[model samples]
Target: MDEQTAGALPVFVFPGSIDVIFTQPHTHKQLVTLYNPYEFPISYRVLCTAPKKYSVIEPRGTLKAKCCVDIVIRHLGANIRSNIGVPDRFRFEVCKYGYTEVSGRKDIAVRLVENASDIARQASLDQSNFHASFPPDGSSRLSPPQYAFPSNPGAPSSQSSPWLAVVAALACIGALMLPTQGDMMPSLLPTYLHLSVPQKLVAAYVLGIVTMLIIRPT
Candidate 1:
């Protein structure tokens, strides 16, 4: 949807993003979806940063459509519960009409400190957190508006970036076609073989494009 062509007034609402850290009972991952209301075009940036220090980790990149955006963060191999001592915070930066105007600048913060004891005691998993809020100053800071990741980690990693599927498939194919240890043919009949490298990549690109084409709130 073109922001310029969208309805007169602008409306935006997001349930917020998920943060997962691998550890303890299981691996965890979080996904956030957003709905956009505007008549002009827009570019959205989803960022997950260290709450205490924003620069510790730069904001990760993800694509957003004119009407909505989704963000996913994965906590890998280690128990997510381990991070109970640490808090995770995130921010969203949106540039619309090629930055001519900005819309829906928001932040989603998670508190691991308060919920740590419960997580360790029950060994229970929680995915609940705070309500999403907007910050007057884009800078990250401690405040009541912040939220916490409620559950221990559950997933190893966020799904690979949709854009990488194609390149990854091609890379795997090229690797397989090349000779391997002991001159092995590298299982040419592997299930992945059914999806040729180029074909797989093309399919991925199509899926991503289609996903954007059908962008809508869930």
Candidate 2:
């Protein structure tokens, strides 16, 4: 253990720089180990200045004295295409807490490199990976109807229409009266209950649309 005295405060020194290589396709996963040489346990945080493309595991954690922790680096396939020829530079800043006087900061630069052949191979692999991760089944795949809006010529003007506001206000009044109004409820309940499940569902959906249109700011 190497000890350095910084203005009377004794600091335990450890080796800092760690180099990591991430080859395309085959070697997408890489691990970095950080060792603490101090007698007491220390808390540390690992930070990177990369975009959402990179997934880092165990970036921040506590390390026991004289023990080491492994940080996993996974390159997301979505962001890898943008960093084909150029190296994706990630500066890892490991800062130690507890000791305010001593600046226990370690800076490590991890470079993600890929050759032309590797990039080509990874692209195909990424496509396959994406498909495998999200299977084209009803459970995993989202239907277009879930996200798509109704294609109506009158939709653009509906927002400004006073009729839409009236319909929305009626829907709100109906919703509020359904639970409280006893005499009107019996007649209305039978109308809703007499309809098939699908028809009731459509009615409920239309009511939701009306409610949304009413709440939406003009």
Candidate 3:
């Protein structure tokens, strides 16, 4: 929705951009107040277009006429603690009741920080941060520090489990032994062959081990 066209609506969103700072594993909820100036009650639907991990608690609800309603945007810190440097953006489309089009929209920009201390340090306090300056000598000055989030070293990487490797090894060994054992025991081969390739391999190795133990009784 265009910001210029939003003024025509009877509803207004205070603090159009919802900014949130997450520093720990917990629930963080930010409130976005919606004011309805019409005399009749208006229903507003909040649509969040962002990662599934981030959610808007009261996404769809009605606002009383000539009153205000708070729309809550929430993020679970647990899901975000290990996701530093990943920015989550949400476009909230607020549509009026019975209207097929969006009446107003707000963009919620979320930045995940490693710690609480970084939140204050990364906040932009001056408008000058957006502009670059040059000296009278025509020499360019250094730009302001860019916002950076620390990576979580302890986060686990995507990898297969150790047990899966063991299972694969067992299956390979069983497959190799099946062909040789089947030749010696032709009658037994049919019974083993009835099973799938994987099943046959596992069964052959198990039976071979059992036969060796039985023959070497002590």
Best by TM-score: 3
lDDT of 3 by residue, 105-171 (tens): 4444455666666554444431123122123221123121111111221222222333444565566
Tens digit per residue, CA lDDT, model 1, 87-148: 45555555554553445566555434333344442222322322223234443442311222
Score every model by TM-score.
0.39, 0.39, 0.44
The local distance difference test score of each candidate is 0.42, 0.44, 0.48
Higher lDDT: candidate 1 or 2?
A: 2
Model 3, poorest ten-residue lDDT window? 142-151
Q: Which stretches of candidate 1 lie over 4 Å from their true place?
A: 1-13, 17-27, 51-66, 76-82, 111-136, 139-218
User: Which runs of model 3 end up more than 4 angstroms from their true locations?
Assistant: 1-7, 24-27, 77-79, 120-218
Residue-wise C-alpha lDDT for candidate 2, range 1-218, written one tens digit per residue = 22111122232223232222344344455566777777667665444334344456665566787788876655553234455433333332223556532244333333344553454544444433333322222122322221222223123321246576667667655554443323343464644434444544555677777777766774
| Higher-TM-score candidate of 1 and 3 | 3
- Per-residue lDDT value at 49 in model 1: 46
Q: Please list the Cα RMSD from the true structure of every candidate, rounded to 1 decimal place.
A: 13.9, 17.3, 15.6
Instruction: Check candidate 2 and list the clashing pairs.
Output: none
- Tell how far residue 145 is off in model 1, in angstroms: 22
